[model samples]
Target: MGASHKKPSQDDSNLEIYSLICLDPSFHNNEETVKAQQQLRVSINYLKIFENCYQCEEYIRSVSSYNRFILIINDELARQIVPRIEQLRQVYSIYIHCLDKITNQQWAKQYLKIKCLSDQLDMLVTRIQSDHRINDLFPVVIYNTNELNFHFLYSHLLFDCLLRMNSNNKNKFISLCKNEYKNNENELNIIHEFEENYSANQSLSWYTRKSFIYRILNKALLTQNIDLLFTLRFFIQDIYQQIEQKKCLYPIRVYHSHLMTYEEIQLIENSLGQFISINSFLSACLDRGLALFHLYEPNDLQRVLFEIDADLQLNDMNHFGYIKLVNYCEETEQIFFMLGSIFRIENICLNDDEIWIIQMKLCTENDCQLKSIFNILRNEYHYGQDSNLLSFGEFLIKQGYLNEAEKYYLRLID
Candidate 1:
């Protein structure tokens, strides 16, 4: 590794790819535009304000495909420009914020991508923030056991590497988080508190703070966005270390309820008696009633109640733990599992309430199949070690994320 603790160069700063595009001509020099960004919880620098459809369209076209734009435009300009950019994937969502909503609704109905048409900016901003966060809450990756997928194996090995790694990147994490939430006063205040009060022991508490940090970090895991994930690795390690220190001394059971896609439900059903891994941190409660209480009536999604029987007494099975100290909710008994904890699907069925209950048993080094493949990856790719952060770079290269891997190594190089 290049310079052991040298500050990351400026070349690595702008990893946040969200572009908030404001296309209202009235917003060119208006103080109200700043208020809208604050309400939307978007930073000022990330919000690109434009005065005309021409300039807005040019900027939309200029933004790299890696960045997504949440467009807030007046209906008149939206009508003029929506047709040109409606099909583009970079335009994540579009909202028409004009007085004549009744008139705009007629034409806006034709476009499938327009998210909302509102005369009220506050309501529109709330809607925008809700949609943005709701989008981030879901979208986790799962391994399918019926196929020869290697993601679960990679997850085990890579997170193992993250366990023993250390970095002087807490300042980098704080800076990046502040940049992401700059003009959003509530989260900015939280970031300040986090920077001032943060410690390794407080990682779980911060992770549970129902704010930008946890959501953005989870989103990074979902998309494998290495830049953000790597920046936040120090926090990840802290949580893991905390879990290890407080691990359950014996066998225990926990439950978690979430909305899962029908496909994911079926994947679990089809893979019963085999193994699967979720690619993010897992939190579950000891109270089954608490788990059932949170389940929603299914619409487009399936209600999944995960019943985990974790036997930490097994060799090398201290991957999850009971933590009431900083367990977000004081009322419930919470067990926090580190990222990518593998589980054998014991059974899957619908209960009398019609909710899918997936019964899973924690797998450990004692599991022959898991241990064998884990060793193969560790020895074959030189990434089985938990001794250093450099193995993560090697794992990235093995996964074919060349650009992400290169950037990771550049930060590691002395």
Candidate 2:
């Protein structure tokens, strides 16, 4: 080796450090507190000092980003900070160093690492730096508080974790959910009963209740928990009522991606029909057309297609929706609507090859007029190749059009 060089410590070089010092107003004369404050400022890149607990809270709300927090506070200040433990837990890795003994040691244990004045500040800094896997850590509410409802938080965390999991892991998670629900059926029933009773007596408006349920609905949508979504359809109706009252089209837009039953799709369409203008309603309906196509019976599918065609004609809008419908019909071998849709959209929204193939196939199968097929081939496609002419002649012969077949062969020979 030419020369020897020393690498910097990962803890010192890599980690972003933040410290919060809540100074006791009564401890201005205290030597140890002053020394700890000095040590914190020297060690951390960002250090915030507050004279009292109130200022500390104000700073907590104002300060936007931080990786770790070192709180140096007195007993009374720590008590004031307890209410904010849930919020602080969400964003920061917290370590508390109280100058005096904390009265509520149990609460402190649940939320923070209580340290003595004599303990080295380096240890706290070192601990934060060593844990490089903070981003990988899932959101978990470690402490139980009666005031703060964590049910939604727990569900949100589970949904996020489930989303990141592979298919096998997701199946395992679903199995786990089923097993847990079976085991806790009685508890679940009791909780449901309590919620119903509570809702009946509560001063909360229906809108407020709807807002709460909407959060759960979003979680269900993200997880693709169709059973959970079905159970929540009652709440969705409540949201729909609010949307109707306000004549707002935004909420109806959320249903676009949802995999719903035919009845549910019809219900949404009917509800939207009342408030929206004809053109807007028709345009919005297109969003759920595919979902309806998947779920509807043959009779219902025909009804839906008729309604769509009527709306497209009434509004004088182009039949772009029919493009997907035509492709789906082709895949399913339901050619009844294919020719109609292709003919309706004069300049069909398909590639040249696709259009040619569909046109040729439909003409051969349906015994279409020879002049119309010849017009498309000569005027539209200008297909002059011998192979294409021969193929068309063979297709005409197969369709019992001997004169048309002879004409194609004569044109190719010329």
Candidate 3:
């Protein structure tokens, strides 16, 4: 399996533009406001004119890149529309033209005053033309009171930005975040510094801090930054506690899917020791059984199997984990271990055909007793006049067990 080494680019055809216009009805009589509104309408009309330029072009949609033109008539409308604009800023390079600033002035890289619509329109066109770099314009973060919980909104915005960045930039951003969080034991202090540094002087509420921490933790895991992940785990023990309490399997899934090195896996296991339940740990081990078997020594794999078996009692069977373990053992050619794992699974959990297939293999390889196989068929499986019984009889003949083959054929005939 080869990984694709794709680098991020700022292609103009891939970029999108969104223009948000919020007109304050309270300033209806003001000449400046009326002029601003008129200028905005004209600007939007000029931008729309490019839509037809791409009709005959192969990339028709790519030509204009203008996505949406939203108009807000009042403060209440602005309040409702600004948060949506903030959300859109993650993907589009939004040029907001409002009678008054709907959000922080520094939200976007460029803020054009709409005194003269013609002048503003020319500036917008010139700015976009000069700087065709998507990285320079994208992920515009805006602060709004619509979502009163600043921490939640900021965290999501930051995470979204981090995801969009290239690997090098993403690592740099994570490093910056880590530096800010250093020596800050207080959660509230960390939140304050994060908000102040990144979110334009906004502060996070106590209740929303946990959500922010969890978002960062998720990003760290996604990027496979074990160091950052461990650092975050130290600060947010409650987040891990919540995952353990809810028995959420997503973190384990993420670990298995992303973390490749044995050292990284060991770090996570040690950090989460005692916090992770035995069942959850066993399930994770089973999920990563093939990887573990390939990466670790035989002793380590045996130790993992022992731990799993110790957690599982004889009467406790029919679990999804057992099924996965048995499959892994079979694929690795550990026949006896596969048989032992199969024994832990309840008979009811398996179909008669499947049971017969496993028994036939065991009988041929280990010379398992005919009486034991018949007991399982008669008592456990209740195998009578079935197609599987006939198949098993033929299989026995192929294995040179003539006497056992004859017994099965006679039973089927009777």
Candidate 4:
């Protein structure tokens, strides 16, 4: 409410009114006041120009205090004035220090005005049947609120309507939005709208005409909808070929994630399973390394060890562990663990110095002579002979001889 008139002075009561503003809803917080002030401070100069013409300095001063305004004016002036104010407010902001007087009353007025305008705009276009009304207004309002230049608003609004409409009614809204695009220089918001609506129940095919499925695919993981992620993968299979040929990171992340589900894996794998390299598998293995512990038996562990060794010895043409672990004795640890697995030795012991020779010598397969040496190492007599007992203890653990490994590991400490 306007400050109640105390009638303290006749001169003060005679103040001129530039425009009368009324707020439909009031704000009740300080944060909204700060936001309104930030938005308005940038436009104060332009607003000052209007204020001067109407001699509304007192009203302007009040608005300037906390930077909120709900000035009412003739509807014709409003048609031009409201949009300019709204537009300027969208992009303009000043430092907080300049608007230190921000308060609840000012914010309440601004917030109510914004809600009123947004609601009015929403209601006005709900019934518009053609693209003509939206052609001049939409994109401006949708992406940039500057100057209320709603040149693109109609397209976005129509797209929203199209997405919500039944299959039969969808054509009408799409046609309206399309007509605006075709007649003007604007790209149909088809691509933009599809992205907006794709995550909804709306299908991915609806946006394919604009080639934005890649971006949609990129964001599909965020949807938490495995169904949608699968749908996106299926839709982009061909594009993924080109994307893979180019080695694009975005598509790769989407395609490689476990989030896609087994069904999704089959979809992608069926298309390019052979081309999905071991490097890619290993990359995923590195990420999914915990899968190693999930296996229920020795055979599963043996199978994994065999595959890892085969990959290292054959395809890798170099030791995998040498690169993976620093100061690693590739031949010794590698051969010993592999041999331990094969022989069921259940343990391999080595001191720090002996650990290196064991790792190196184990690299190449030698027969029962090395086997006898391994057996001697496993005997209880040599368990604490050197610091390498822990190394063998770890190998025992790796070989699934956990009890024996713990005995050795705890020996020096105990």
Cα deviation at 236, candidate 2, in Å, is: 51
lDDT order of candidates, top first: 1, 2, 3, 4
lDDT to native, each model: 0.69, 0.32, 0.28, 0.25
lDDT of 4 by residue, 163-263 (tens): 22222223333443344234222234443464345432222123222232322332222111222232333233322222223221211110011111123
As for candidate 1, its clashing pairs are 1-414, 2-413, 2-414, 3-414
Best by TM-score: 1
Give each model a TM-score.
Answer: 0.74, 0.24, 0.19, 0.17
Model 4 ranges with Cα > 4 A deviation: 1-101, 104-188, 192-215, 247-414
Steric overlap count per candidate: 4, 0, 0, 27
lDDT (10s digit) by residue, model 1, range 1-414? 000111112232234445578887687466766677766654323676888899888877765443567889987788899999987756777888989888888888887668888888878888777766544334345675334344554455556655555655589878877776666678787778888878989888777765567766765665555566667888898888889898888888899887765656766676779876666778888899988887765334577788999877784743887886644455445798878777888998888888988898888855777766656656765554553367666666766766766876775552
Clashes by residue pair, model 2: none
The positional error of residue 221 in candidate 3, measured at the CA in angstroms, is 3.1
Please give the RMSD to the true structure for each candidate, in Å.
6.3, 27.3, 26.4, 30.0
Better of 3 and 4 by lDDT: 3
The digit string of per-residue lDDT tens for model 2 on 1-414 reads 000012111122112323444445643457755555444433332445667767767666554332335555555666677556535621344444444334446566665244323134445444443331221111111111111222222222222222222222123323433343343344334335434543321211321222223223333433323334334433333333333343322111211111222442343333321211110011123344453433222211112221222222222111222211112114211111110111121121223322110110111212232334334444433333433434544544655656645654553443
> Model 2: residues >4 Å from true position, as ranges?
1-17, 26-30, 89-103, 112-414
Q: Could you give candidate 3's per-residue lDDT for residues 1-414 as a string of tens digits?
A: 011112111232211233433333343466665554444432222122111212312222233322333333333343343444433312223333333453434342232211112223334444443322211111111111122232222222222222222222123434544454343334335445554543311111211232334334433432223234334322333322222233322211210111122332342233321111111111223333553443222111112111222222222211222111112113221101110112111111113322110010101111232334334443532333233434554544655657645744553343
> Could you tell me the TM-score of candidate 2?
0.24
Candidate 1 is scored at a TM of 0.74
